[model samples]
Target: GGDGAEEEQWSQPGNDLSLPAVNQTKGKCCFSLCPGIKIPKVMDFLPNILTINDSSLPQARTRCLENGIGYREKCFYFVEDEAEWNRSETFCRSLGAHLATIDTWQELRFLLRYGGSLHYWIGLRREGSAPWTWFNGSLFNNSFQIRGRGQCAFVNGDGISSDWCSLMKYSVCSHPQTRPTGSRRDPEVWNLT
Candidate 1:
Protein backbone atom coordinates (compact mmCIF):
# COMPACT_ATOMS: atom_id res chain seq x y z
CA GLY A 1 0.00 0.00 0.00
CA GLY A 2 3.00 2.30 0.27
CA ASP A 3 3.64 2.55 -3.50
CA GLY A 4 1.88 2.17 -6.93
CA ALA A 5 3.88 -1.08 -7.57
CA GLU A 6 1.26 -3.08 -5.63
CA GLU A 7 -1.43 -2.17 -8.14
CA GLU A 8 0.89 -2.80 -11.15
CA GLN A 9 1.57 -6.42 -10.15
CA TRP A 10 -2.14 -7.38 -10.33
CA SER A 11 -2.12 -6.56 -14.08
CA GLN A 12 1.17 -8.27 -14.81
CA PRO A 13 1.19 -10.77 -17.64
CA GLY A 14 1.36 -14.45 -16.56
CA ASN A 15 0.70 -13.51 -12.96
CA ASP A 16 -0.85 -16.37 -10.97
CA LEU A 17 -4.04 -14.43 -10.37
CA SER A 18 -4.27 -13.28 -13.99
CA LEU A 19 -4.24 -16.78 -15.47
CA PRO A 20 -7.41 -18.63 -16.42
CA ALA A 21 -8.38 -21.77 -14.50
CA VAL A 22 -7.65 -25.11 -16.18
CA ASN A 23 -8.37 -28.62 -14.98
CA GLN A 24 -5.17 -30.39 -14.03
CA THR A 25 -4.80 -33.59 -15.98
CA LYS A 26 -1.97 -35.86 -17.08
CA GLY A 27 -2.77 -35.89 -20.81
CA LYS A 28 -3.81 -33.22 -23.23
CA CYS A 29 -7.40 -31.95 -23.10
CA CYS A 30 -8.83 -31.37 -26.58
CA PHE A 31 -11.68 -29.22 -25.28
CA SER A 32 -9.45 -26.77 -23.42
CA LEU A 33 -6.73 -26.67 -26.08
CA CYS A 34 -9.04 -25.63 -28.91
CA PRO A 35 -12.06 -23.79 -27.63
CA GLY A 36 -15.39 -23.65 -29.55
CA ILE A 37 -14.26 -26.00 -32.37
CA LYS A 38 -16.29 -29.18 -32.64
CA ILE A 39 -14.30 -32.36 -33.20
CA PRO A 40 -16.45 -35.18 -34.54
CA LYS A 41 -16.52 -38.34 -32.43
CA VAL A 42 -16.42 -40.65 -35.46
CA MET A 43 -13.28 -41.53 -37.40
CA ASP A 44 -11.86 -39.75 -40.44
CA PHE A 45 -10.12 -36.39 -40.86
CA LEU A 46 -9.34 -34.36 -43.99
CA PRO A 47 -6.01 -35.47 -45.40
CA ASN A 48 -3.27 -32.89 -44.83
CA ILE A 49 -5.14 -31.48 -41.82
CA LEU A 50 -2.27 -32.29 -39.43
CA THR A 51 0.34 -30.98 -41.91
CA ILE A 52 3.81 -32.42 -42.58
CA ASN A 53 5.70 -29.99 -40.42
CA ASP A 54 7.95 -31.53 -37.76
CA SER A 55 8.37 -30.27 -34.23
CA SER A 56 11.86 -30.15 -32.71
CA LEU A 57 12.08 -31.59 -29.20
CA PRO A 58 14.77 -31.44 -26.56
CA GLN A 59 16.68 -34.70 -26.04
CA ALA A 60 17.61 -34.15 -22.44
CA ARG A 61 17.60 -37.78 -21.29
CA THR A 62 16.61 -40.52 -23.69
CA ARG A 63 17.27 -40.68 -27.44
CA CYS A 64 14.36 -39.12 -29.33
CA LEU A 65 12.98 -38.65 -32.83
CA GLU A 66 14.87 -35.81 -34.48
CA ASN A 67 12.30 -35.40 -37.25
CA GLY A 68 9.19 -36.61 -35.49
CA ILE A 69 5.68 -35.45 -36.32
CA GLY A 70 3.80 -33.72 -33.53
CA TYR A 71 0.13 -34.47 -32.88
CA ARG A 72 -1.40 -33.31 -29.63
CA GLU A 73 1.27 -33.74 -26.93
CA LYS A 74 2.94 -36.75 -28.55
CA CYS A 75 5.54 -37.15 -31.25
CA PHE A 76 5.05 -39.73 -33.97
CA TYR A 77 7.58 -41.16 -36.38
CA PHE A 78 6.01 -43.04 -39.30
CA VAL A 79 8.44 -45.54 -40.75
CA GLU A 80 7.60 -45.84 -44.45
CA ASP A 81 9.26 -49.22 -45.04
CA GLU A 82 7.63 -52.48 -44.01
CA ALA A 83 9.08 -54.69 -41.28
CA GLU A 84 8.01 -57.49 -38.96
CA TRP A 85 6.32 -56.56 -35.70
CA ASN A 86 9.30 -57.44 -33.50
CA ARG A 87 11.70 -55.71 -35.84
CA SER A 88 9.44 -52.68 -35.98
CA GLU A 89 9.36 -52.57 -32.18
CA THR A 90 13.16 -52.73 -32.09
CA PHE A 91 13.32 -49.87 -34.56
CA CYS A 92 11.04 -47.77 -32.38
CA ARG A 93 13.07 -48.63 -29.30
CA SER A 94 16.18 -47.28 -30.92
CA LEU A 95 14.47 -43.90 -31.16
CA GLY A 96 13.28 -44.04 -27.53
CA ALA A 97 9.68 -44.42 -28.68
CA HIS A 98 7.17 -47.24 -28.95
CA LEU A 99 4.59 -48.37 -31.49
CA ALA A 100 1.80 -45.78 -31.60
CA THR A 101 -0.99 -46.40 -29.09
CA ILE A 102 -4.68 -45.67 -29.72
CA ASP A 103 -6.04 -44.71 -26.32
CA THR A 104 -9.18 -42.99 -27.55
CA TRP A 105 -11.72 -42.99 -30.39
CA GLN A 106 -10.24 -39.74 -31.65
CA GLU A 107 -6.80 -41.32 -31.85
CA LEU A 108 -8.23 -44.28 -33.70
CA ARG A 109 -9.97 -41.95 -36.14
CA PHE A 110 -6.85 -39.89 -36.66
CA LEU A 111 -4.77 -42.99 -37.31
CA LEU A 112 -7.31 -44.46 -39.70
CA ARG A 113 -7.24 -41.37 -41.90
CA TYR A 114 -3.52 -40.76 -41.45
CA GLY A 115 -2.48 -44.16 -42.72
CA GLY A 116 -5.20 -44.19 -45.40
CA SER A 117 -4.68 -47.25 -47.62
CA LEU A 118 -1.27 -48.13 -46.21
CA HIS A 119 -1.02 -50.37 -43.15
CA TYR A 120 0.82 -49.10 -40.09
CA TRP A 121 1.69 -51.36 -37.15
CA ILE A 122 0.39 -50.01 -33.86
CA GLY A 123 1.14 -50.89 -30.20
CA LEU A 124 -1.78 -53.26 -29.60
CA ARG A 125 -0.73 -56.81 -28.77
CA ARG A 126 -3.19 -59.45 -27.63
CA GLU A 127 -1.65 -62.70 -26.44
CA GLY A 128 -4.01 -65.57 -27.16
CA SER A 129 -7.45 -64.83 -25.61
CA ALA A 130 -5.97 -62.32 -23.21
CA PRO A 131 -6.92 -58.62 -23.35
CA TRP A 132 -5.16 -56.28 -25.77
CA THR A 133 -2.30 -54.35 -24.24
CA TRP A 134 -0.42 -51.26 -25.30
CA PHE A 135 3.36 -51.25 -25.78
CA ASN A 136 3.76 -49.50 -22.43
CA GLY A 137 2.09 -52.42 -20.61
CA SER A 138 -1.23 -50.61 -20.34
CA LEU A 139 -4.50 -52.38 -21.13
CA PHE A 140 -6.45 -51.35 -24.22
CA ASN A 141 -9.70 -49.68 -23.15
CA ASN A 142 -11.67 -51.15 -26.08
CA SER A 143 -12.31 -47.60 -27.23
CA PHE A 144 -13.58 -48.87 -30.58
CA GLN A 145 -14.35 -52.11 -32.35
CA ILE A 146 -11.18 -53.93 -33.40
CA ARG A 147 -11.40 -55.98 -36.60
CA GLY A 148 -9.86 -59.36 -37.54
CA ARG A 149 -8.17 -61.92 -35.26
CA GLY A 150 -4.47 -62.11 -34.54
CA GLN A 151 -1.71 -61.27 -32.06
CA CYS A 152 -1.07 -57.72 -33.25
CA ALA A 153 -3.07 -54.73 -34.47
CA PHE A 154 -2.49 -52.22 -37.29
CA VAL A 155 -4.24 -49.20 -38.67
CA ASN A 156 -5.46 -48.87 -42.26
CA GLY A 157 -8.04 -47.05 -44.38
CA ASP A 158 -10.94 -48.91 -42.81
CA GLY A 159 -10.01 -49.11 -39.13
CA ILE A 160 -7.87 -51.00 -36.66
CA SER A 161 -7.19 -54.59 -37.79
CA SER A 162 -5.48 -57.59 -36.29
CA ASP A 163 -2.89 -59.70 -38.15
CA TRP A 164 0.07 -61.99 -37.60
CA CYS A 165 3.04 -60.34 -35.90
CA SER A 166 5.31 -61.72 -38.63
CA LEU A 167 3.52 -59.77 -41.36
CA MET A 168 5.49 -56.91 -42.87
CA LYS A 169 3.93 -53.53 -42.17
CA TYR A 170 4.97 -49.93 -41.67
CA SER A 171 5.29 -48.72 -38.09
CA VAL A 172 4.02 -45.66 -36.26
CA CYS A 173 6.35 -44.89 -33.33
CA SER A 174 5.08 -42.82 -30.42
CA HIS A 175 7.36 -40.58 -28.35
CA PRO A 176 5.81 -40.00 -24.97
CA GLN A 177 7.16 -37.18 -22.86
CA THR A 178 7.65 -39.33 -19.76
CA ARG A 179 9.57 -42.17 -21.43
CA PRO A 180 12.56 -43.17 -19.32
CA THR A 181 16.11 -42.42 -20.37
CA GLY A 182 17.48 -45.94 -20.12
CA SER A 183 16.96 -49.45 -18.89
CA ARG A 184 15.80 -49.97 -15.30
CA ARG A 185 19.34 -50.57 -14.06
CA ASP A 186 20.52 -47.20 -15.37
CA PRO A 187 17.39 -45.24 -14.59
CA GLU A 188 17.85 -41.48 -14.52
CA VAL A 189 15.48 -39.36 -12.51
CA TRP A 190 13.95 -36.72 -14.74
CA ASN A 191 10.36 -35.69 -15.27
CA LEU A 192 9.35 -34.61 -18.78
CA THR A 193 5.63 -34.66 -18.02
Candidate 2:
Protein backbone atom coordinates (compact mmCIF):
# COMPACT_ATOMS: atom_id res chain seq x y z
CA GLY A 1 0.00 0.00 0.00
CA GLY A 2 0.97 3.64 -0.31
CA ASP A 3 0.92 3.99 3.47
CA GLY A 4 4.60 3.68 4.34
CA ALA A 5 5.93 3.94 0.79
CA GLU A 6 4.81 7.50 0.31
CA GLU A 7 5.76 8.52 3.86
CA GLU A 8 9.30 7.25 3.32
CA GLN A 9 9.87 9.99 0.79
CA TRP A 10 9.37 12.67 3.45
CA SER A 11 11.27 10.77 6.15
CA GLN A 12 14.44 9.83 4.33
CA PRO A 13 17.51 9.37 6.51
CA GLY A 14 19.04 12.71 7.64
CA ASN A 15 15.97 14.65 6.50
CA ASP A 16 15.71 17.55 8.94
CA LEU A 17 11.97 17.28 9.56
CA SER A 18 12.20 13.71 10.77
CA LEU A 19 15.02 14.35 13.22
CA PRO A 20 12.92 13.15 16.23
CA ALA A 21 14.61 15.63 18.55
CA VAL A 22 12.77 18.95 18.57
CA ASN A 23 15.95 21.02 18.89
CA GLN A 24 17.44 19.34 15.84
CA THR A 25 14.32 19.96 13.74
CA LYS A 26 14.65 22.71 11.18
CA GLY A 27 11.39 22.88 9.21
CA LYS A 28 8.89 25.67 9.58
CA CYS A 29 5.60 25.23 11.37
CA CYS A 30 2.99 23.17 9.53
CA PHE A 31 0.96 26.22 8.59
CA SER A 32 -1.98 24.49 7.01
CA LEU A 33 -3.25 23.55 10.43
CA CYS A 34 -1.93 26.69 12.08
CA PRO A 35 -4.59 29.25 11.32
CA GLY A 36 -3.29 32.84 11.43
CA ILE A 37 0.22 31.55 11.01
CA LYS A 38 2.53 34.29 9.84
CA ILE A 39 4.72 33.37 6.91
CA PRO A 40 8.42 33.67 7.64
CA LYS A 41 11.03 35.44 5.51
CA VAL A 42 12.05 32.20 3.86
CA MET A 43 8.39 31.60 3.06
CA ASP A 44 7.72 35.18 2.00
CA PHE A 45 7.65 34.05 -1.58
CA LEU A 46 4.70 31.78 -0.90
CA PRO A 47 1.46 33.34 -2.03
CA ASN A 48 -0.30 35.14 0.81
CA ILE A 49 -4.07 35.22 1.11
CA LEU A 50 -5.44 37.61 -1.47
CA THR A 51 -9.14 38.17 -1.64
CA ILE A 52 -10.27 37.42 -5.18
CA ASN A 53 -13.77 37.17 -6.51
CA ASP A 54 -15.85 37.33 -9.69
CA SER A 55 -14.64 40.84 -10.47
CA SER A 56 -10.94 39.93 -10.24
CA LEU A 57 -10.82 37.35 -13.04
CA PRO A 58 -9.12 39.48 -15.66
CA GLN A 59 -6.39 40.70 -13.33
CA ALA A 60 -5.84 37.23 -12.05
CA ARG A 61 -5.51 35.98 -15.61
CA THR A 62 -2.98 38.66 -16.39
CA ARG A 63 -0.89 37.82 -13.34
CA CYS A 64 -0.86 34.10 -14.05
CA LEU A 65 -0.03 34.39 -17.72
CA GLU A 66 3.33 33.53 -19.46
CA ASN A 67 3.34 30.41 -17.32
CA GLY A 68 -0.25 29.29 -16.68
CA ILE A 69 -3.87 30.37 -16.90
CA GLY A 70 -6.04 32.13 -14.35
CA TYR A 71 -9.73 31.59 -13.89
CA ARG A 72 -12.02 32.80 -11.21
CA GLU A 73 -10.01 33.71 -8.12
CA LYS A 74 -6.92 31.46 -8.43
CA CYS A 75 -4.13 30.98 -10.95
CA PHE A 76 -3.54 27.52 -12.36
CA TYR A 77 -0.22 26.34 -13.75
CA PHE A 78 0.16 23.07 -15.54
CA VAL A 79 3.43 21.28 -14.88
CA GLU A 80 4.50 19.17 -17.84
CA ASP A 81 6.78 16.83 -15.94
CA GLU A 82 5.14 13.77 -14.46
CA ALA A 83 5.47 13.10 -10.74
CA GLU A 84 3.76 11.23 -7.97
CA TRP A 85 1.12 13.13 -6.03
CA ASN A 86 3.24 14.13 -3.02
CA ARG A 87 6.31 14.96 -5.08
CA SER A 88 4.16 16.99 -7.43
CA GLU A 89 2.84 18.97 -4.47
CA THR A 90 6.35 19.41 -3.07
CA PHE A 91 7.49 20.72 -6.44
CA CYS A 92 4.71 23.27 -6.34
CA ARG A 93 5.50 24.29 -2.76
CA SER A 94 9.10 24.89 -3.77
CA LEU A 95 7.77 27.37 -6.32
CA GLY A 96 5.81 29.20 -3.62
CA ALA A 97 2.53 27.59 -4.61
CA HIS A 98 0.46 24.51 -4.06
CA LEU A 99 -1.24 22.12 -6.43
CA ALA A 100 -4.36 23.44 -8.11
CA THR A 101 -7.26 23.81 -5.69
CA ILE A 102 -10.63 24.00 -7.43
CA ASP A 103 -12.88 26.50 -5.69
CA THR A 104 -15.94 26.32 -7.90
CA TRP A 105 -17.58 24.72 -10.90
CA GLN A 106 -16.39 27.47 -13.21
CA GLU A 107 -12.77 26.91 -12.23
CA LEU A 108 -13.28 23.20 -12.58
CA ARG A 109 -14.81 23.72 -16.01
CA PHE A 110 -11.88 25.85 -17.10
CA LEU A 111 -9.36 23.28 -15.90
CA LEU A 112 -11.16 20.42 -17.64
CA ARG A 113 -11.29 22.34 -20.89
CA TYR A 114 -7.70 23.52 -20.59
CA GLY A 115 -6.36 20.10 -19.74
CA GLY A 116 -8.59 18.41 -22.33
CA SER A 117 -7.80 14.70 -22.17
CA LEU A 118 -4.49 14.89 -20.32
CA HIS A 119 -4.29 13.55 -16.80
CA TYR A 120 -3.05 16.23 -14.43
CA TRP A 121 -2.53 15.60 -10.74
CA ILE A 122 -4.39 18.06 -8.56
CA GLY A 123 -3.91 18.91 -4.87
CA LEU A 124 -6.87 16.93 -3.54
CA ARG A 125 -6.13 13.74 -1.65
CA ARG A 126 -7.39 11.57 1.23
CA GLU A 127 -6.10 9.21 3.88
CA GLY A 128 -8.02 6.02 4.65
CA SER A 129 -11.73 6.89 4.79
CA ALA A 130 -11.24 10.52 5.64
CA PRO A 131 -12.94 13.04 3.39
CA TRP A 132 -11.02 14.68 0.58
CA THR A 133 -8.84 17.65 1.46
CA TRP A 134 -6.66 20.11 -0.38
CA PHE A 135 -2.93 20.17 0.26
CA ASN A 136 -3.54 22.86 2.88
CA GLY A 137 -5.89 20.58 4.82
CA SER A 138 -9.06 22.34 3.79
CA LEU A 139 -12.02 20.07 3.29
CA PHE A 140 -13.27 19.67 -0.26
CA ASN A 141 -16.73 21.26 -0.34
CA ASN A 142 -17.93 18.33 -2.46
CA SER A 143 -19.04 20.88 -5.02
CA PHE A 144 -18.43 18.35 -7.78
CA GLN A 145 -18.45 14.64 -7.74
CA ILE A 146 -15.10 12.89 -8.12
CA ARG A 147 -14.90 9.39 -9.57
CA GLY A 148 -12.36 6.52 -9.66
CA ARG A 149 -10.67 4.72 -6.75
CA GLY A 150 -7.47 6.03 -5.26
CA GLN A 151 -6.03 8.44 -2.69
CA CYS A 152 -5.07 11.29 -5.01
CA ALA A 153 -7.11 13.32 -7.51
CA PHE A 154 -6.51 14.14 -11.18
CA VAL A 155 -8.55 15.86 -13.82
CA ASN A 156 -9.23 15.04 -17.45
CA GLY A 157 -12.08 14.99 -19.97
CA ASP A 158 -13.64 12.41 -17.71
CA GLY A 159 -13.73 14.95 -14.90
CA ILE A 160 -12.07 14.54 -11.49
CA SER A 161 -11.10 11.10 -10.32
CA SER A 162 -9.26 9.55 -7.38
CA ASP A 163 -6.28 7.32 -8.03
CA TRP A 164 -3.23 5.85 -6.40
CA CYS A 165 -1.03 8.60 -4.93
CA SER A 166 2.02 6.88 -6.38
CA LEU A 167 0.89 7.15 -9.99
CA MET A 168 3.08 9.48 -12.06
CA LYS A 169 1.21 12.17 -13.98
CA TYR A 170 1.48 15.73 -15.14
CA SER A 171 0.43 18.05 -12.31
CA VAL A 172 -1.14 21.43 -11.87
CA CYS A 173 0.24 24.04 -9.48
CA SER A 174 -1.62 27.15 -8.40
CA HIS A 175 -1.45 30.15 -6.10
CA PRO A 176 -3.28 33.22 -4.93
CA GLN A 177 -1.94 36.65 -5.84
CA THR A 178 0.23 38.82 -3.61
CA ARG A 179 -0.72 40.25 -0.25
CA PRO A 180 1.08 42.36 2.34
CA THR A 181 3.69 40.53 4.41
CA GLY A 182 3.27 40.55 8.18
CA SER A 183 3.49 38.58 11.40
CA ARG A 184 1.40 35.49 12.06
CA ARG A 185 -1.57 35.84 14.41
CA ASP A 186 0.00 33.86 17.25
CA PRO A 187 2.83 35.19 19.37
CA GLU A 188 4.20 31.75 20.15
CA VAL A 189 5.43 31.19 16.62
CA TRP A 190 7.49 34.27 15.99
CA ASN A 191 8.21 35.52 12.48
CA LEU A 192 11.34 34.07 11.01
CA THR A 193 14.29 36.39 11.48
Q: Summarize candidate 2's per-residue lDDT along 68-130 as a digit string, tens digits.
A: 666665778899999999999999887677899988788888889999899999999999889
Error of 2 at 187 (Å): 34
In angstroms, give how far residue 25 of model 1 lies from its true place: 35
CA lDDT for candidate 2? 0.67
Q: How many residue pairs clash in each candidate?
A: 0, 1
- lDDT tens digits, residues 1-193, model 1? 2321111111222222221122223113433433332223101221212221212222243334576766666777889989989899999988888899866677677777777899999988989999999887899888877799889998889988999999999999887554222111101111112
| Per-residue lDDT of 69 in model 2 | 69
